[model samples]
Target: MTASDARRPVQLEIAVQDAAGARIAFEAGADRVELCQALAETGGLTPSAGAVEAVLAVAGRAERLAVLVRPRPGGYVYDADEIAVVAADVREVVRRGAGAVVVGALDAAGGIDTEALSRWIDAAAGAEVVFHRAIDTLSAPVDAIDQLVALGIRRVLTSGGATRSIDGLGTVEALVRGSAGRVQIMPGGGVRVEDVPAFVSSGADAVHLSARRSSGDTAPSGPGGGASGFDVTDGAIVAAARAALDEATSGS
Candidate 1:
């Protein structure tokens, strides 16, 4: 087989905050799901042990599941105590049947915290490890990519230092080229249906998205115009993304 032909097929990974969302994403053809909590507020937090078990129970045999291991949100930098919490959470999720754990940690200088990250990686217990979007916050992403590859990270999810992958296409493409197949660069953040083909064309081996939509389950307004209920994953959106990825890869 040709070198390119022998490469693994592109994949679509959906980030879902709960079991209901997990079911929708899976049924709609998601190849993998990153299970987490408080997506609206924290981007994503480490899901409870029970939550991880419940999502895995409903996943299909073909669908892989990864759990985010952030103890809390806000930032990727963590103190020693926080690092301990992250390590504990990673072990808990793996024990609960997660096939992989999504994690990242930055030092005070805004670079990959290799020391802190090592603890979580060791806690993964042989499961796949994906460095999360904290890569985007790095002062030098290319340099960080080298570090992660050396550390044996399977993939790095990033928007190429932009708020959206489409806006960062050039950087993402550069990252793909720079990795030289040593690591997979998965573009994420505000990925839309129309953007999938472009991302695939840019050499992203995989893509991540939330596929979230308003479920019309609003909460009562408390005080002054506060945030409403959680947005659920839309099966239609997930299906469309899957179809888009299929079309992109098939046409290539």
Candidate 2:
């Protein structure tokens, strides 16, 4: 690593589904927050306009927040109409004070959708563009890093093509080395506080996690009797992760 890069502290990014989660993340000392909606149901999807406004209010700075632009919960392969919707959502979120937009799309061949990516970049109108975990779906994700860099993407959130970031540490390290400071490689997906040191030692620019805990009524009710309770960001988890990252990167 370059001398300057070695001195750069690792960032801690928390994924949140609402304003309240944003507040928790902020208070926990998060470097940035990725705001979304329906995280429990769909992993994450584009939040409503009001949701964006609320999160921005708590973030206090646009660059402290990034909003996911996924139009649906399903696969990243999008139809024309879905692409149009994504474009509109990107513009809307950016206009609403999102400093960065997390987005990804795949072609039928299971590769990055350059066309859709270009459209989203244009719609962002200067806001940072982040390529989400869709890169993990590729057979050779390391090779795709260069493609993303060429596309002017500022960052990429990934689990190194594995279900959990910890299990994919080797691949994550390769991705970090392969990026060569061109694009930020953030290890995400099932990342735990215990895993922070490993990722930090890998030279990752940042680490991302939902850090959520569930609450609410578990009594049988509603259509499927599914738990009526919901998940919220756990401040304790965020704070623990923050401490771990700081400890790991200390004197590096």
Q: TM-score each candidate.
A: 0.93, 0.95
Colliding pairs, model 2: none
lDDT by residue (93-197, candidate 2, tens digit) is 999999999999999999899999999999999999999999888999999988898888999999988889899899999999899999999999999999998
- lDDT of candidate 2 at residue 162, scale 0 to 100: 82
Question: Candidate 1 has what TM-score?
Answer: 0.93
Taken over the whole model, the C-alpha lDDT of each candidate is: 0.85, 0.91
- Residue-pair clash count for candidate 1: 0
- Per residue, candidate 1 scores C-alpha lDDT tens digits across 74-128 of 8888999999998888888887788889999989988789998888889887888
Model 1, residue 37: C-alpha shift (Å): 0.8
Model 1 local distance difference test score: 0.85
List candidate 1 stretches off by more than 4 Å. Answer: 1-8, 61-63, 221-226
